[model samples]
Target: MLFRQLEYLVALARERHFARAAQACRVSQPALSEALRKLEDELGVLLVRRGRAYEGLTPEGERIVRWAQRILADRDALRDEVDALRTGLSGRLRIGSVPTASGAVPLLTGPFCTAHPLAAVELSTDLRADELLRQVRDFEINAGLSYLPEQGTEGVRTVPLYEERYVLLTGPADGLAGQPHATWTEASRLPLCLLHPGMQGRRVLDGVFAGLGLAPAPRVETDSVGSLFAHVRTGHWASVVPYAWLHVFGVPPGMRAVPLVEPVHSTPIGLVTAAREPGSVMARALREVARRTDLAGVLGALPKA
Candidate 1:
């Protein structure tokens, strides 16, 4: 019944172990167990599955965990709101982004930090579109920067940031360097270094190739953009990357970037946050940052894709 109990329960659900959960909550093991039991007694339903180890949450516990997440989120939102009124917005803002959008993140974060110097902004690029949404929904991240989902999703509001276009980055020594544009089919035939299949960007590229009836077998696959840059910078490898990336990370010394054409496709990328009304002050600030950002100016300066 207590907010502390909800906190403990949520922590337990996340950690999935009594001792670790207690450690996360900065409490002793017995205290965490007692709090959960008291919570169950107050609610008259078991909130955890008991065993020598953390078996899992009970069915009712599963549902309660969700509610606990919402309640804690709302509680934090309330606290942030009150503090913002008194201190002009001070709190940590967490944002998760897909790796391909790594370059574009600074566009939002820069202004956000400038506008609210007192606030702390943490940006992570190690998540996929679905994972980004999941973390946002779970309140693990305050917001997400990712490709817009095909179908509208529930419990989240999206603000379209910009359209992502494809391009091929290779060194001047590469054969295709002088080409005005390359098709997905042609790009697939090169000794290409590409993002892992798990990445949403890779999936989009794969879809383009599949539609052309071309299956690309990459020479090297990596999850790190830096790795792709490292290989391609040698002028021996070519890679397909977002056009914005060219602007973000300029065509490195010897590299040249060519737009991907002949069935060129563009996907919408955006900012996503929980749909909760009266959203956290930081969340609202990020929304404003998204709105005020000149995405066209940023992406437009880049070579067209």
Candidate 2:
């Protein structure tokens, strides 16, 4: 019934352990347990499955917890709205982005911060596309930067930000360096260093090669861009990265970044927010920033190899 009780319940559902959930809620174990029991009594349903340890939520508990999430999100939205009316926009804006889109997030965050100096932004750039969307839908994050889902974007609003283009980065002495452009076929022949298979960017690059009846044999594979860049710095490794990355991290010394052409490819990356009635004010603010940002133009203006 109380918002505090709902908060505890949602934390419990997320943590799946009583003590950890209580820790997240900043309350004692007994306090969290008593609150949930009271919530169950008021709702007339057994909300948790208990057996000396935190087992899991019951069937009805599962459904109720979803509603609890909604209720809490709506409550936060109301508070943010009222706060904005009084003291301007002020709150933490949480955004989750797929690792490949890491460079592009600054386009939105930079403007958002300047526009609303009172607001705080928390960015998580290590999430995969699937995990990013899930957090957006759950209200665990205010918004997400990722590719549009193929099947359906049922529970979120999509705001297309930019078209993500690929570019081949190589050292000066590398095989394809100084070239105006490199095809997927040509790039695959080098001692490549690419993102690991689990990343969306890797999957996309693999699909492109698979269509050509070729599979890239990477000499080095990594999940971190820093590591990939380090390998490319050796002049013996080449990697394909998104063009937007050049906007944030310019071509390092002794390196070149050429557009990947010969049947050019681009992925549509966008901002996703929960499709709820009273959405988070922070999300709405970010959407406004996205509309005003000339992301495509900014990324396209980067110097070409």
Q: TM-score for all predictions? A: 0.95, 0.95
Candidate 2 error regions (>4 Å): none
lDDT of 1 by residue, 1-305 (tens): 49999999989988889999999999999999999999999999988989888899999999999999998899999998998889878899999999988788988889998998889988888898888998899898899989999875898999998999988888887677788887777788899999999989899989989988999889899998778889998877899988788776677787888888988799999999999988777899999999999885788556532
Q: Once model 2 is optimally superposed onto the true structure by TM-score, how far is the C-alpha of residue 288 displaced, in angstroms?
A: 0.9
Weakest lDDT window of 10 consecutive positions for candidate 2:
296-305
Q: Which digits, one per residue and each the tens of the lDDT, describe model 2 over residues 112-168? A: 999999999998999988888888888899999998777668899998888888889
Best by lDDT: 2
Tell me how far the alpha carbon of residue 266 in candidate 2 is from the true structure, in angstroms, after superposition.
Answer: 0.2
TM-score of 1: 0.95
Query: Could you tally the backbone clashes for each prediction?
Result: 0, 0
